[model samples]
Target: MNFVYEKMMGGKKGLTGFLILATLILVIFPLFLDIFRLNLVGKYLTYAFPAVSLVLLWGYGGILSLGQGVFFGLGGYGMAMFLKLEASSVENTKIQSTPGIPDFMDWNQLTSLPWFWEPFNSLTLTILAILILPAAFAYIIGAAMFKRRVGGVYFAIITQVIAVILTILIVGQQGYTGGINGITDLRTLNGWDITTDSAKYIFYFINVALLLGVILLSRLILTSKFGSLLLAIRDKEDRVRFSGYDVSNFKIFIFCFSALISSIGGAMFTLQVGFMSPSFVGIVPSIEMVIFAAVGGRMSLIGAVYGTLLINFGKTAFSESFPELWLFLMGGLFISVVMFFPNGLAGLWDDYGHYITDRFSKSKKTKEDSPEIVEKKSDESAA
Candidate 1:
């Protein structure tokens, strides 16, 4: 058990952190928050998927991608295609000129389902698309850039540009891609109504489970030989390449893996939010995701979740009363984190948490060595 804990959980500290986060999300939040608030938290948790991926790719692997939203949107659109089809049954949309297709397509005068969207009519195919499309897209990008030794700021800029281009494409192809409004009014999944309160609870739990699973998988990768190589590549790529390692392959693999993780989040977002939009597929949300990682301690997976929740909660709260100021507030918050708390909340804890622990330990020792306690022990021994 100890060996397993050490290997899988990073020993006691890691295990404790995982358990605490699990308790907070899985138990405490559900017990305290009403269903509506819990649902919002679930949405925030979905965003954490990308944040966690950023932690792995940017924090650990030293690969900063500024367009994770691209993969996220692909996954979301895949699931949305399935749900939209389910909701647009011949019976449901008989009034439209083109029955059995998404309303948006009918509104655009599309007479038939697009060839690409045909695959999403099946739940099985939709699931596969959600899982496969993002990784494949990421592999192509990573291979192109990493193979040519193009990285750092240049790679970041390329990713941002791709995000912009993809958003423009989605917005321009109104008949096919749902345009700027995005794939909306998603209603069910494989015959199950996903908008009911009960469904919300179930989906929230599922999201939590998937997130925990992703974190564990990421942790496992971090503790393995591959993880060490990732760090080596991040720190000294030329040296690793000199050591006979195919550096680009490692970079490509992690990039693909991170894209896959983000896509899972996107799928869950569609399930929970009942829609997917091009708004989430742009450079802004992608950068906000990075801020989540940065504020949560990019080096810490669990911290990513907290960072996501904190920032999103702030956005919601601030937007309620001062909507115009929220963006500026967020920008300021990001700047503060970067300038003053670069390591993020996790770094602050690392810097200060031990002081509390030390105080408790010292008090316990003082009690154990107190004169009265020592005299009592001596008396007991003599007796």
Candidate 2:
């Protein structure tokens, strides 16, 4: 009883600290920033949303999901569809048409409205679909895959194939989906005109706050006993099964939750950028999401956030300052980390703190051996 009580107390304290610090940063975030910096942080937060989810599903639950982009796309495309419809003429009400769409539909030689496109014309339905479609897909997929004991690479491949197929299908349905262009030319979202600079800033803050919420939520789940069961299932599912625990149920739970997180990220993404392209949800993008969480040291939540910030920051800086060679520059950066630091940037953080502590401990030893000389050596090493 005492152990449980103490654990609960610790959990509450930790969660409180996290919320306080996160709130502090966000509240003061706008004060110390130019619009450009604010916008960048917002973009970072948007990316961080999925990073949080991946850290849970892959990091804590030991489920490597490559089809995260599918959920992301669902949210994005769902929101985009709503925003597009909101911009259309209500008098026509049925296929009022978009600049990107009506023209393409005309070009594709389709005279009448597409049936599937009708539901997207309503904002409430789109918002509901934004949350529902991805989750429903996740549930079905999770149910089938988990119940059959399908996991690891087979699950990974199945997800990857889904992403590839979805992208191809979107491309093939040019008139309906805008083809290779995917979904862009979004003029507004909700009732607000997304064109104003202030609107952009507000949107950025909204994304950041949402990202922070996800981080806190994931942390809560990890600190709970549920997290313990997840890790057990990951490391030794058969043993867990022998112990009378249902591994499949836990796996599905995590998968579905992660899908919801990805969906939210996608929704924020479309709101901020006003674009939802197949490129953002293709096989490569799916793999990139995995690489992101992997680079963050899949075991650590802080690692996920750190890795995301590092990668996105590097991309932004290199692209802006050295447009011609940014790709090479970013590739070199990742390679350096992967080669020298096998566990990733998160591993580096742990190793770095360990190095510092070791240094101090060694210095203390040397100080006892030769008090005067130890200071010089310590100073040199610290530098």
| Distance from true location, Cα of 24 in model 1, Å | 0.8
Candidate lDDT values, in order: 0.93, 0.76
On the 0 to 100 scale, the lDDT of residue 199 in model 1 is 98
TM-score of 2: 0.80
**Candidate 2 local lDDT, 1-383, one digit each (tens):** 65433443234333343444476447776788787677666666666667778888988787888888888888888887777656544442345343323445656776665777688877888878887888889999999999999999899889888888999988998877778987666777666778677987888777877776676567667768898999888888899999998889898888888888888888888887777888878877677677677777787665667677788878889999999999999888888878887787668756565565566678878777795677777988999
- Worst 10-residue stretch by lDDT in candidate 1? 352-361
> Each model's TM-score?
0.92, 0.80
Question: How big is the RMSD of model 2?
Answer: 8.6
Quick one: best lDDT, which candidate? 1
Residues 313-366 of candidate 1 have per-residue lDDT tens digits of 989988987888988887787788779988997787678766755676789999
The true-versus-predicted C-alpha distance at residue 377 of model 1, in Å, is 19
